[model samples]
Target: MKKLLMFVCLSGFAGFPSTAVAAPVVVGLADGLAGNRFPWSTTGGMRWQQVFSAAELTGFVGQNLDQIAYQTVQGATGYTISSLVISVSTSNNAPGSLSSIFANNIGSDNTVVFNQANVTVGANSSSGGFDFALPFTTPFLYTGGDLLIDVLAGGSSSAATFFRANGSAVTTERVYSSQGSPGDAGGTATSNGTLVTQLNFTAAGAPELHPGGAVLPLTFAALSCLIFSRRRRISY
Candidate 1:
């Protein structure tokens, strides 16, 4: 009976530890370009078109996505960033028709992890850009893949929004134009060799356990229990 009790206890204690207090891991992509100017501000007609860029997230396969950070620039009149949307997909290419890449058009394959209409980034004092962080109300599990973040400014023509530019010879970033509505279809997305944007995010989870490590704890517990049982029998 004692051996059976020991076996039950060992089985229950062999599972992965809870990650209640694990520190969040920060992941980011920097815009290597030197300029502070906003790209794609003038390309998407006067309607609401957004630039699309993605960063490959490694080591964050099973973490929970917490927040996203982005940089933007404002015009003379200043701009308000009322909405921010983020989507995730395994594919590097934009999903759906080239003309539109809205949340719905991407189909069920994509997950919109963050959606908010009241996001605000105050006006800039100069042409230089500023950075802001948007926290997710409900975090989502990051199944280890690339993240695509879309910044929208309510389709206002008076104000200009900018994403940090990457000067790399080649990039995964693409630009597309939408009618400014979440449901509206967008124009074909294109990538210019000179322009790309930066992206960053935070995730929270315990470090993954290796196979050997997982087995070590259970083995130790079973051995200790066996020793205790043998000692008790000898004393009796």
Candidate 2:
């Protein structure tokens, strides 16, 4: 009877799934200077429509933009991750097109990479790149806040000028063809034109999803049965 019972238990172990076999999935959230809300959508292959200007983005650094708007993994267990990459793109236009990037710790009042990069637009065809590696001590975990990008300035001497916030400069230079006429500079070559840009957040590796309390309870019940059966044979 003891040998028979042992055989049954070992068979059950073979049937059960191993906890070590599951892989995790990761999710990330991104925010702009403006309060467009969390879980911002991505469309047009890689273009994001909800870009924020510099002034609209000032108070949000080092805080979770999720308090306003954020994104999440569809189904995943919260766990420590290896690293996260945040990307910022500046306009690739000629002049007045630049994107300045910044980051701050969530909850604490410190700059991660304050004004980290001032990108040129036309250098990358309406876009540039900014990536940050998670600091070893920080581990880069999101609370309902933190992680965001802002547009500090934008415009062109030959293009329309617009400020994301206060203290921005916009020049009215007509350089279509260097014509003396104000509106008819169509023949002049434009100068100092600035284009708008975007920011994004991505994570590396997989995240584990919580199986929920119900599944755990069922697993416990089965484990208990196995233990009880083994005890009965040993007692005899």
Candidate 3:
């Protein structure tokens, strides 16, 4: 929310001071091709989520994350991600391997930022790269700790989204599935790699209120059993 101040001469009252929002701050890998084919629709659809640690989000302590964008190395128009839903949360999980239990990954205030039945994301013609930028309906406030982004979409898709990513971005972990639907239990937890995420925030940080409960899609229920593996841990 933008701040405004007004003064009235009739009452000889001077308006209180107001503060302007700061410029947006973006953090994450900018470009790389070693990523999954799509954050969009992949065969059998997909579910994707990545957590960013507090150290990486240093400057965004009080910021309101209003938008998130994904960069694709190869993409085109006409392709659509069906049953798309993008959600965010302050995760108890960190940059390392995500929990096999889904709820263990989510912290306080799970909120859905974007949801669309079907939509086409355009390519950035000038840059020769395509970007799928989704604005949050309810901008998430980054109070502190690790930030988690959960992306899910169902249905078969022909176009390959091929989002840019880096293996060297900080310790990373993601839960993903190729055999995903809009209403699946959960995906396999991978203890490596993360999408090069782009986060946009209100400079002054929106004065957001904290909610008591979470509004998440993949709530309680353990993920399909899989072999456990060693995970990299983000320092406390």
Highest TM-score among the candidates is held by which one?
Answer: 3
lDDT of 1 by residue, 1-236 (tens): 77786776666675647433333433233344432233223322222223232334565566666555445543433444344556544444432222344443342345566676644554443444334455666565666444444444343333355555444323344445443433445544543322333233334555444346657766777787778788878877
Runs of candidate 2 with Cα error greater than 4 angstroms are 18-46, 49-210, 213-231
Candidate 3 on 108-185: residue-level lDDT in tens?
799988888876666533573336778788887778888888877666355555666765555456777555453455
lDDT of candidate 2 over 33-136, digit per residue (tens): 22211111111111111223333334323322211112221222222112122232222221233222122111242223322222221211122121111212
Instruction: List the lowest-lDDT window of 10 residues for candidate 3.
Output: 221-230
Please report the candidate that would top lDDT against the real structure.
Answer: 3
Model 1, C-alpha of 39: deviation from truth (Å): 9.6
Whichever of 2 and 3 has more TM-score, that candidate is 3
* TM-score result, candidate 3: 0.69
**Deviation of model 3 at 100, angstroms:** 2.6
lDDT of 1: 0.45
- A best-first ranking of the candidates according to their lDDT comes to 3, 1, 2
The superposed Cα distance between candidate 3 and the true structure at residue 120, in angstroms, equals 1.3
CA lDDT of each candidate? 0.45, 0.26, 0.62
Q: Predictions ranked by TM-score, top down?
A: 3, 1, 2
